[model samples]
Target: MHQEPDFLHNLHQELRDGRRWLDRSIVLAYAAAAGLCVVAFTLMADAGFELFQRIYRWQGGWAVLLWLPAITVAAVWATRRWAPGAAGSGIPQVMVTLDPAVSEHQRSRFVSLWLSFSKMALASAGFAAGLSIGREGPSVQVAAGVMHSARRWLGPHSGISSHALLVAGGAAGIAAAFNAPLAGVVFAIEELSRKLESRSSGLIIAAIVLAGLMGVSAFGNLSYFGRIRVPSLTWNALLPGLCVALASGVLGGLFAKVMAASLTSPAERMNRWRARFPLRFAAGGALVIAVIGLVTGGATFGAGSEAVKHMLAGEADVPSFYVTLKFVATWLSAWVGVPGGIFAPSLSIGAGVGHNVATLTGSDSIAPALIAMGMAAFLAAVTQAPLTAFIIVMEMVDGHAMVLSLMASAMLASLISRMLARPLYETLAHHMASALPGPASTQDPPEPAHAPGVPQQK
Candidate 1:
């Protein structure tokens, strides 16, 4: 039999009621919100995949070259016309929302909702047309927007409460998209929210768990890439793995620098030229399509998840040419105004690099380890979130045994990238947002000292 509460409980009630009740209600509300988010994301992913399959069957090769450009133009135009803040990864918009400098007029609920829908529709269409982008980033924005919209019915104070739920929804979306619960939670903390307060942590964790459960129930308990088997670890392979990690990290840093330079240079140029915006964007789109066709033979278009799986399975034997193609494709995709996430493409690039290195060295034993390490290293370098990168890969591959090497690689890559320059997303967003006309401010608000890159003030 259960025992009743004792004198301590009675004393607690005597201490305070308002704070205690509010805390309890917040926890309960968050739990409910997280559960709802999980259900929504699961449905969305299934629908998105089906829609993409149908589009692929209908479009054929022109999917990448023609349809992608058209959709990209529409999406870009919609963002520029209605929701300029949603132009890029959407993370920056979230940062801007939290910025104190942003006036109330700019932070309208309608803007968030419109941006969310546009991102979802455009990202979904991009995936359907085989563009090199992932769904995770867009999903985060969509989910957060959904939570934010729900605040209207929950009362005025719901906006304040929605912040926590927004983080939760984002975590749920990531978990559902990638089937990585821990990574979702870690990412929400490390990359997006950049806060570890108890309220936030509790909500995010709750959301991740609910989303994971929903994903398993609907999609089965499978890693994003299925079962990635790593050969048994050995001391002899350690040196080569380390070397691969170091190289990938350095290269990843250079990649981040390249993206930042591309984004910022264009902004600087725009200031000088004051060029026609649509014409410039269209030209960039055309260039991206041409480069993708030339370099990848059209293989690098879209999310590149299939290509990544092929690399992991050791099915592709194209040599360094393959990695080079992917790198170019990814760069072009980003350089153009395609609304998508780089995480998957980055992983594919890393895998190709690792696979090429292994082939050159004839070190089959260490190839898998190197591939995994390369992914962590490159991602850490680009995003400047070493721990999040490590955990994300570990969760995606379910490779707990590879943790030590992943950690080492992530640290090396993140350090090298930091030495090279700022985190890619922040730098790109800052410049791009600034270049746009209107009342929007370009300067980032004072972020928490501990927050990665730039902090968004509450």
Candidate 2:
């Protein structure tokens, strides 16, 4: 056999070592991105909460009427002018970017670091103004941007698939935002990526672990909705569970349908009006929310966190109309193109609905179970992602014992929701994909031969 050159053999060995190093480096980069996202998102959420708390304390509901319209106009203008890509719940943007039909350029248009920063700032501002949105969805977009940008930074040495980074970033974001790692995993598999590639298993886990640790360090190991000590379910619990599920499913389905309808292009009268005069329409939505806040004693404000907790603990004396008010607020926020999310508020709505169910049935003992089911059911109805809905609720409330109940509610609600509306994210994603520019040519461009100052070969 011909002798191999020593230089060639050494180069080969070096290449293999470099490949191994790059692989390890990619993992570190992913973990770092996840950790950074968790910290930034936590601070963003806390700051938004503090802003609303202080403003409300100073003037209460009247402040919303005064501030919300101006805030909505500024926020809407900011989102449209500076970061149109960051508008609305960001999960749809991620989902749209992941579609195979969308070109890299189109994906980058919406998921860049610039847009991510805009999302964080605008979304926090919306929260501060008591927009009925959540921090969770925007966090997903921000985290995904961190990882997506990593692909550009690492160049050929990234050793990470672009799609994988998007999925991992979103998964890790959910894990950190709600302190629910398992739900993150399930969300990645069931919704974000729609498939868990075997090759990416370790990478996804690393990001989740890093983000989860960061969240724990900052917020401690408390459940997003606090731990609910659900007692053993009796036959009595079943009736209320069914009632809550049916109500949440039907109502959540209608909410999804109306929301999707509102987001459509200007062919529809409602969407046309919103299109013809966006600022005015947006202000109207804000005004409606302010009026609801005034009527509900602000129960419908700020993602409904306090009201949900109170209702879940069976201590809230919230108005009978609060659930409807919250659902309408969420719908209006979606229509007005605010930068926050429905994820947190949706659960709160479900909890409120469940409390109503308990009241109607005259059963306090099963309130916790009913509330848990309502969360699973309504979220499932809205997103049409049953597994994600149940797993998230199970993780959030630490109600592992009610897993079966939650799952049943999720399935039933999803089925019922599909009857009323297309999957919310999926419909939005389809619209996004349809609206994107045509794909670029597949042929590769010629490579540069030298650095900027160097001459090219003749």
Candidate 3:
């Protein structure tokens, strides 16, 4: 073969190198765009809740009771009519899209810009409706959708898999939403991917950093739940910590069990009824949630993030049955076919459990510590992703001093949760995967069978 000149070879090599850089730049752009989307999402969610609060303050309980059902009816109707895939905690949808068996055409319906936008808007409506739902889970889908949108721009030759995009976007969502970069990374590894590929490590970190920077710029560098001054763990504190952990484990497990049962009810008739009369069903569920809110003096409404903050600050005076009532409220909200998440509500419920445990044990001095532990343990139990749960709680509370205890509590609670319910998100993902059209659905590897019904578009 004739030898090419060195200059020609160098020129070709430079072109190749330039293309690689361009591809990387595109990915960075996607990451940055995802972060911007999350920031907008956070603002929208907060604004919705603020509007609801204003309405409540203006007209009192009657207005709230009416607002919830009416908005929920609208939200549920809009969800079913337009973006059915946007319903519920969107984590499961993202999880399903990651399945290699799911074709790109199929995955588009699950993770696309339109679906993500609808999810954000509808979830904000849920917040305005005083639904006991969170934005964190929806954030994952939104960011994933934004990140995944680059597929057409960067062809298959770009060496970036859809898997990497989805994972990065989802992780970025967590980082931005909670302002916890490390927790975001751990969540990607522990919950989203189960195992992070070495090739994706740089991408994941870059996404998290970009998203987290956006969060910091918009919200300030503060803990998600505000920091607490926890005393060093001592033998005297062990008993209280353990009690909180046990309580969180059982309660969280119960919540998981009930959730699984509600979603995967063996009663096909009920599912049919719900499908046929989605508006009526949503209205009914909304009515129950409104009643729960009234009974709890509105403590159980709107994801309970504020309530958890109040408890941590020792400024809350929750009802004795707050935990159970909030649990019912969150579950009903999810059942109402609205677009929202359980993450914040779950943390609130955990805080209530911790409060009750501290009160029962007369450990007021260490209540904050117990509350932190409960948040971690219960989340761990519910998700069965102990590392992610613990890291989230740790970051939210700035609880470095309580690291060991939080880890222990999360591990124990996750173990106990397994005894009562299978991994909640994975099981739900399995249900969703099984519902996809085509033979690939049948080829999904075995996963936990005990899952609830997924939000399917009619």
Candidate 4:
């Protein structure tokens, strides 16, 4: 009898351990799935942009005039009708889910699989229409949704909570989207979770690694903007860095402020008009973008990545007005309530600003360094997340030599941005939380499947 009881206990213990490993394995599997999704989305976005370029080359201005408005209407309408949570850059949506005030029900809706599907499909549609948007931001939500879906498969004894899944998914998204694993980890700490829990550290890093591995497998070992060769920066480059930081800070701050105002403040006339007739408003915004594109010879169109790459390669000289028009185009693209992101567009605008600063300073010799700084500074100012911005820019161009400069520019620009507006993602997350149907709750939300685990703080 004693031997039988011991044998049963041993078997039970082994089975329990097996179950735990299996549950953890599910998390890893889902993370890899999220990475695959991001890689696919990247391919889809590039294909969509190629299609738009073909149309633009054939009919030029005429094609854009009719094409942009029609696609804008379709994207906006589809988002509103099907997946309302898939609107905007999607970063705010993921951020809102992290708020403690939001109920599990609300959080689930925000990051559902349907929303992820719609986000990718509709965002790709916007790309085809030549919208000035990026995929990195939306990738966060998409990956989060994919990861969150794993909650259904996890057992009650599973150690990883739903919150951890969401955070891991988001980090994985960034890692895969940009092929920047460290930047993704920084983004999770600085922007997504606001604090990296000891318990979640391994999971987050693993997710980023898996996601990055997926990207590397598909694209090979290439940086997002390719390796930009930068020489040693002497004291002379500092002045240009400062100037680029100032311009990016002001412009990025204003962009963030206006975007938040449009979302949270219904009193704004444009918001009111948009609320009444969203289609008309989107069409109007499309018209404005079309006119800007026509005047800029299509430089202001798309996400502005190709233009930035060409500039970095010394193959193209963008018009001096590129920054102003691209900024307006990006702003309008966001305001029109499409499923898109400002991340790439913000980088593009920053590149333009840096180029102009280089031109003005006659620092043609160090233009590449300044361009990289501008990209980091403007992104930092817009998002108000200096570390993430710096690391992202550093990784994108393999700017290991310019680490100190990139960090300083990002920090200064973020500080300057604070004077003009609140943190862009935080402000938008608050608005999104407030717009949810139920009153804010003070009590902690029950975990998915009612299993207890550490919850992320807002």
For model 3, how does the per-residue alpha-carbon lDDT over 256-301 read when each residue is reduced to its tens digit? 8877777766476766788788899898899889888888887888
In lDDT terms, which candidate is top? 4
lDDT of residue 386 for candidate 1: 84
Off by over 4 Å in 4: 1-16, 441-458
lDDT of each: 0.64, 0.79, 0.85, 0.86
Evaluate model 2: give its lDDT: 0.79
- The Cα error of candidate 1 at residue 307, in Å, is 1.5
Give the higher-lDDT candidate: 2 or 3.
Answer: 3
Q: Clash totals for all models, in order?
A: 4, 1, 3, 0
What are the models' TM-scores? 0.81, 0.90, 0.93, 0.92
Q: Count clashing residue pairs in model 1.
A: 4
Write down the RMSD of all candidates, one decimal each. 5.0, 9.4, 5.3, 6.0
Model 1, runs deviating above 4 Å? 1-64, 100-104, 109-111, 153-162, 270-275, 283-287, 317-319, 429-458
For residues 1-458, write the lDDT of model 2, one tens digit per residue.
99877998888895877665576577557657665765786688668867776777675447768787788888898888889899988898898777666778889876888988888888888887787888888878888887777675454744567788888888777888888888888888777775766776777777766766778787788887888878888887778888888888899889888887788665988788888888888889888887887788877878877787787787987899888888988888878987888898899898888888888999788788888888889988888778878988998888888899999998888778877877788777666666676852232222222221233231
Ranking by TM-score: 3, 4, 2, 1
**Candidate 4 Cα deviation (angstroms), residue 239:** 1.3
Per-residue alpha-carbon lDDT of candidate 4 for residues 177-287, written as tens digits (9 for 90 to 100): 989999999888777886766876787689778988999899987898998879778899888889999999999889888888877788888789999999999999988
Between 1 and 2, whose lDDT is larger?
A: 2
